[model samples]
Target: METQIAGSIARMDGSTSQDAIFKDVLAYKEVLAHIMKTCVPEYKDCTIPQIIGYIEPNPQVGQVGLHPDETNPPKIQGMSTESTTTTEERVVYDVRFSAVAPGEDGKIGLIINIEAQSKYHPGYPLVKRAIYYCGRMLSAQYGSVFTQSHYGEIQKVYSIWICTRPPKERENTITSYTLQERHLVGHVTEPVRNYDLMNVTMICLGKPEGKHYGGLLRMLEVLFTGRYAAKEVIQILEDEYEFAHAHTMERTVSEMCNLSQGIFEEGMEKGMEKGIAQGIERGMEKGIAQGIEKGIAQGIERGMEKGIAQGIERGTNRERLQNIRSLMETTGWPAEQVMTAMKIPAADQPKYLKLLSLPQ
Candidate 1:
């Protein structure tokens, strides 16, 4: 019965890309709690409020508490729990948590970084990319741009990677890596040192089913596929009472179930006239993703399709710049690749390439 339900969700997600917005639901507490259960396992009992307070010493004031010198807000929002379909990094951190505060107001917590990667890069590998992100996180903690903070104030950073695609030489679907020291001289035990202050976890969605990760795979199904995995999501949550009560999963189901209303409203607001049908038709004719960019949203929002392109050709250069930026940010493609992929004009390519080199 549960398996049948999950199949329905997969089919639904196939049509609507709701799974692409896992970052939105992440703002909820229940979702964060279950994520913590999968990644750290240590804070399995920590509630939503505890997770918030632990991440920021003063959640009311929005203090990250990541560093003692960190009084002012960091430029990057310091805490981005959502996922954006942008051209930048796909770093989702419940997959990577850095701190954990234990029981009884013990104040044991971590400064965490979670990155979610839907696509795989064989050239760098997920592990290597994860290491780079973790290293950057570690270095960023050396001292704030403001006052100097001691290294002692640096909280443990956890870099967790959840990959929708499996990488080469993947040992297990879920593998945890910790620092270990070995002494071979006197046949003595290799002492596991405490000096290493960071940890990494890699979860591969394509891995074969094992003991514990089955539940995680199901959770991922919901996170990545939404309504397509709705049935299994319910079954999985039923098995875990806490997860069921959290309401994050339930909320996602509700949103997916109600999405038709939103689409209809959007079409109506866009006038749903000949333009609406034409825009949708163009989008389907091109590719839903590519069409969504130039078709309905842009077509309705701007009311010009070829005109936008002509403006570029005439060197007026407004929509062209906006489209390039939108594509770059949304797709995270290099300027050249984006150019080729989008079939940008040869003359326009040089201008676009130059734009990429300039700082955003």
Candidate 2:
């Protein structure tokens, strides 16, 4: 009797925007219930239909105006095409079910609101759950009041929080906050309603005993823990849940597997692009060094050729000049220093300095 439930799974980064996760989660409403029942045994008495009843249409809570028809009570319109009301997404599901316990007056009952949560948010989700429950109950009974209680006195508001992350010893402890009596100074007792607190109950599904949760645990073990789970957990995957049996669980398993593969491929493509960029940088460095060396070699070769050509011409024309230089050398400068100071044709000096500067 299970069918597709609406709502997506959050992305790997836990982004709820990815409709992919929601679509798959919606596809297996039965699985969702199984997990819930396992984690909270109180759910065994709670039917899926009841859970759906506790659930409001909108996943988010805020002021929303329902269509004229939605505002009307549930009734079969006898299949009339002229029924002017239309359904829209603006109507959010604020709850799954409203559990009522009879109050002392019996005229009004205590409302225990049950809200299912899977994604992580920074604020106290349970507080939202409490406020929404109170708001919905107030609105259902009293449209608006500047400042007064209506629909009889609120007996108690219970907010149940189901979370995906396990409670941490340092921070994630199971906690409940409520208005209680405490001594003002001595033995005199005073009630604390700091901002009208309600009974808030938080259950962190990420606990180690989380795996011990029947349906929810089985689902999470396969989805999160993977290969590291114990033998009993592995057996649960092999037996009760279809996500474990890759062959039998086609739709759910296939969808999750494909999504994971796509995410992996996307990461690899980005990495490859980075690697290619590094390779190109290295290649450019090598090319620049080679170009510089080739230019220097070409310049030296041209200079040496010009110098040899000039020396040959000077040798033929130098008898008078050469004898004059020999007579002037009587200045007694060391022969090596005199030779160094001699103005050689600019062409011959170029190749000599070029050869000397090259590393041996």
**Candidate that would win on lDDT:** 1
lDDT of 2 by residue, 176-233 (tens): 5565675567795433322233556555545345333545443553443222323443
TM-score of 2: 0.34
Candidate that scores best on TM-score: 1
Per-residue error for 273 in candidate 1, Å, reads: 35
> What digit string (tens of lDDT, one per residue) describes model 1 on residues 1-360?
121112223334455454433433443345555556677755667664465445444433543445432333211133644333346555445333334567344554466676666555756667777776676666655544213645555555677766665555542367777665665566655322234556788876643444344566656644553334455555655565345333324545545535524544665678768687998898787786776676777667566767777766767455666777788899998777777877878887998677666786
In model 2, the number of clashes is 25
Model 1 lDDT vs. the true structure? 0.55
After superposition, candidate 2 runs with Cα above 4 Å error: 1-94, 102-141, 144-155, 165-173, 185-197, 207-360
Local accuracy by lDDT, each model: 0.55, 0.43
What is the lDDT for 166 in model 1?
59
RMSD of each: 29.5, 14.1
TM-score of each predicted structure versus truth: 0.47, 0.34
**TM-score between model 1 and native:** 0.47
